[model samples]
Target: MSEDGVSAGGGKMRRRDLLTLIGTVAGSAVMYRAMSAMALAGESGFTGPIKLEGDPKGASVLILGAGMAGMCAAYELRKAGYKVQILEYNDRPGGRNWSLYGGDTYTELGGFTQKVEFDKGLYLNPGPWRLPYHHQAILHYCKVLNVALEPFVQVNYAAYVHSTKAFGGKPKRYREVHADFNGYVAELLAKSTQQGRLDQAVTREDQEILLEAMREWGALDKNYEYRKGLLASERRGYVSDPGGGTTSAPIPSDPMAMSDLLKSGLWGSISAGHIYEFQNTIFQPKGGMGMIGKAFGRELEGVIAYDSKVIDIHQDAKGVTATYVNAKTGGPPRKAQADYCICTIPASILGQIPMNVGDAMQSAIQALYYDASIKVGLQFKRRFWEQDESIYGGISFTDQPNGMIGYPATDYFSDGKGVLLGAYTFGPAAFEYAAMSPQERVAKTVEYGANVHPQYRDEFENGVAVAWHRVPWTLGCAAHWTEALRAEHYDNLVAMDGRIMLAGEHASRLPAWQEGALLSSLDAIRRLHQRVMTS
Candidate 1:
């Protein structure tokens, strides 16, 4: 070959390599840019001074809070063609359902296991076994996504959390210790049932049947008022000894009595036959819960405003207009316009937003709750416990502070090389945990595990914390139905006022879960579509 020909070939190769590098760099830039934009938008805390342009042609819509619910609402509305733009105050969507990506791994920090991934521990004793609402939506979405799931007909799983301690010095004398747990459970249920309406939530016909069984078994020397009081004592966080210790104060009768009665009643009726027919038949997806969230976000990406924050929203007679700042724009916030607005921001934060709306909207926003939670996900250097695919356990804290331990992710292919454990917590204690540094939080988590699984303390020390309360957009974890909070308000939580709409996990038909978030968004969209079409 001639020297000139060799040089010519080298030049062509150089050009080709340069083009390839450029393409790769550009692609990475886009992803990084998108992530940064969303993060900044959330930080701007734009419930501040903002402006908007004229409402776009047609009935354009603006939605806020891009968690699962907001994402679902956008997905539905976009298809219906209302020029929708979802404003996610958070850097990313999925609300509480978030995953961390490090190296070649992913872990779920919030949300429950996917319906398809039923056996990954954390498995719901499905059916009547605490369905947690979102599981139903998960099942539904799985079908839509063409994901597969299986049911566990019979699985031996025993690990749970409760607010009670073991009996101490005094209770040891009573012959009560002889009763097996099943017997105790049976006796308690029978006693409560015989007392009448232990579960106020049940109907008259069912109550009679429950009472008859309780009457047949016969109960201990009874104290209708006393037992009810003990239940209330613990219900208020004054956990008592499981060995039959009593509380000092008399328990209030109304809610606590009903609550305790129902629990005893539930356990009494629960059986393997009942489980097969009622609960514990969990379903799992082929992949993890992350797959489901990724699928939903992937499908709805086009409609989501990844880097925009709705700084302020204003609505007049015709429709509502939203003002958003571009996190990507950097210096000054960029601007975007929308018609119908479906905001998924928690009502707690919404109260702080200075958006232009009526007193009702403002009042509802002010009433929202952002329960404190500490979500810790640990990746051990290795799996240190006898982990069965079916059984998951949670540790209970009787007084000061408590923790829930869960096996959130299993290294199916990696042979347990790395495992993900999760827990849910709320109240002032959660706030304190959230205040710790990443390293400090990890240390605390190790202490938490070391208390229960002494063998795995070092393994746990190798873990990390994904403190949601610290995250700007979320600023908290999990929602609860407090005594002061009304269940029905959840339905009207996002009631529409003029042209504005609301949606989020708290505003769902289900208890606060990923399913509720997704379902709430869809619900908002349905209402929005009607408002626009009929308006």
Candidate 2:
């Protein structure tokens, strides 16, 4: 092989081949970040606050569902000189963007009601919690609404990464696993370069710089080895404390063996914070994520009709009509008419509602599928994870059915009680959790969480589990969009059908995010305004 490319099994290895090798080892999350950095992946569609130009000329819009999408439409349209009204099935606003607090009551589709027993000043956001900095649309709303924001820690070194099948079922600190993985990989690369194994891939002058970079980046000693030493202890932590006293010498902990570390699979989770969405500087609304929703609701006070369920929707050549009844009490259906309609109801429930639209739109609605998801909030008598384990915030990942446990980002070190996200499950695990009763789901969360934090067994006071599939208002969580499905139905789904248009997270490329919902609503509102002005 020429000196231009590295020799691999008697064949020249290109840069693309090197990327494939790294992607295979580092997993999809790392690969995605790499691709994104290289401009191979899509960027956030949110370009800033949307401007809805033109006038509706006394036209009115009836919006369905009071979630982020519906609320955004009403807020912007009402400001643009259009008469806007929102019909929300729930008694409260912010459909999926909800927070459960003390004295709140929730009755699922199965008639099982759970009265939240959390202490005052404690809350659990059952939906979107952390807001990525790149989601500028939602952030813009938060700023305009004057909603207070706080930093949401995405990764804590003290948190745990656990797998029941690894490390004899014991949880390992994230920092230790992370440091060991990086150290071992860097050391191996440095050794390979020194042995001329990478001569083709790196020039001799670049190799000298690479070796030095690896040594420092990996926390390696003078020998470029990742092992038990002061350098390694600084990154992975020390077994003993270093103090001012004479007998306070710190003991450097031994690094886990490369083979053992690889088998543990704990390194798989270390890349979570590396993902573009969960990277550092993420924020959460003060109190809870629902604060943003509450602010929106307050701003759109008399415009939203609470507890109004739409039973049927029809449009004629003149206008659109929505027949709705009181959601809580059975009553005669009432009609609400408008020149146009914006439907933001999630596809999971929207598919069941009777609506007259084009065949393409109807087929698109039916084809959209929502995934099942479960979130369990467990209130503990004390913040044991913080007090005992020193885990203030961030998430602890596990291979258990519960998937992961998130520590409270607010009220750090408070002497009072705190709530933890005991379980956040999706896919098959979520379906299994949904099949169980709410109480059973909470119990399962505690049971699975104990594997990570043993204090869960003793400190668990009460818990509330939300299974999106069983929730009456939204039969399932956010829309699950496959590329094939998006290619087939996305355009029809978003296109204005007569006087009716659809807007939600599902309508945009960024599924399952508030930004998607906001952007989708903005796009729909712009198109609807254009049509009205032309007419």
Candidate 3:
């Protein structure tokens, strides 16, 4: 046997093999612990392309909502020989996957209308902007639909993190706060180890290795202390950068004390990007997130009946039928029929619609509540954030009503006009913003954004604000499911109910994401296709 307890000829066992051995010998909990220690967790459940094997045999399906979920269902079902038709409430294809650009006009539920005045190429994605790298289903569709994508900078070291109650109400660079916090934590741990406080937890040999690793990782001095020095400057950056000329000297910036950093609460912003969904390598469609929906709409031309708002849904043993009305004109109701139905409507609106389903399905539909969110997009005559603050792209978080200010991810270094997501708020702030008029919301967003970007008043040209609760079609943002609700009603909501099935972000574990909608649609149709083949 090898020294590490493997066969002599096996060499060093691979990580997967070691994990398998641990799982086999010990329990899954032990294997999980091993994996966590190695930082080899978080695998995507999406397996490649979904295959609907066997002929669908002319089964007709009626899909509601032309969003990602509905469009995905229509595309795949049609390819699998199922006759498909989609009913959409809006005059366009994308539901919440929407963008606003020059000349675009929107009227909220309170009858407040705003016409976007952005430059020709500048636009704002009002919903679902950033796409995680692990969302394979949506990425697959992006590839299929030929949607170009670019990196979305979720975290930039140069960006600012501000708190009104700390640092004299001033903002600090992300790198300084992040590096200092890490360095102080490492220094404390190293001191504890050296004092023999961690003797029981760490071996004498391992303690040496840990101290060495911590010194390097924490950018500490030889004596295992983090203080004012060149080593610390490398991570948090120097106050005066080194230059290659006659006056070429570098001055190290002092590291913040542990008490000051902890009191500032800037560490909270550092972990925003560390969250699984917001990690690096996140992407956005080249033009806007709406590109995906627009591409799907073009591919499924004439298949989607735009502005056909579904009023009621009825299903029997043989087939399903839907009653609809023109969303714009409010004319007499019309009816559409199919062998099966995949309803992708948000539960906030779907609960009010009359649907003939079991008591369990009805209860599940009513049990879900949608979240409220508000986004404000502001257009500027000049790219003041880039030119003045050197903030090209990324978010600046604050403890204000606006919550966060997101710089434009596109059109970097351009001399022309630019747009920025001025405000993005959720929870109570969202509701407060929703209660205001659209104009009031825009004015308030500009007022709050001025705190972060002082150029807001002078550079501001025009703006648009979307209070999700005021949206006519969705009524609110994505569904918010509690742990108890998921345990009691989630399966019943997604399960095929007689001749009908439900598909959307509301039906999947990943809510409010296009990936969740696509995945839910794929799973729903996969089961529906199986039923079709058997019947």
| Ranking 1 against 2 by TM-score, winner | 2
Candidate 3: how many backbone clashes?
0
Task: State the RMSD for candidate 1.
Answer: 24.4
Candidate 3 versus truth, CA RMSD in Å, comes to: 6.2
Candidate 1 minimal-lDDT segment of 10 residues: 169-178
lDDT by residue (tens digit), candidate 2, 1-535: 2333444544556645654665565597777767775452235556566677776788999999899999999999999999999999998888888999999998998798999999998988888999987788889999999999999988999999999998889998999999999999989998998788988998775565566568767997767789998889899988986777788899999898999999888899899898878987799999888898899999999999999999999999999999999998969999899999999988877888899999999999999878988999999999999899999899999999999899989889899999999889799999999899999999999999988888888899999999989889878888989989988999999999999999999899889989899889998998898888888
Q: How well is each residue in 1-535 modelled by candidate 3, as lDDT tens digits?
A: 2333322122444434654654564587777766763452133335677788888778899999999999999999999888999999999988988899999999999688999998998888888999987787888899999999999988988888888888888788888998898899889988998898988998765565566567878998877899988899999988888888987899999898789899888889888998878976899999888999999999999999998988899988789999999988999999999999999999999999999999898899999888999999999989988898788799988888888888888889999999989888899999999999988888998988887778888999898999999999888899999999999999999988999899999999999988889889988998999888887
Off by over 4 Å in 3: 1-45
Query: RMSD of each candidate?
Result: 24.4, 5.8, 6.2
Ranking of all predicted structures according to lDDT, beginning with the best and ending with the worst: 2, 3, 1
Off by over 4 Å in 2: 1-45
TM-score order of candidates, top first: 3, 2, 1
The pairs that clash in candidate 2 are: none
Report, for every candidate in turn, its global Cα lDDT versus the true structure: 0.49, 0.88, 0.87
- Cα lDDT of model 1 by residue, 298-412, tens digit: 7777767775655666777766666667644645655556666777777666666678877766755666656676655555644554343223322222222435555432233
Residue 109 deviation, candidate 3, in Å?
0.9
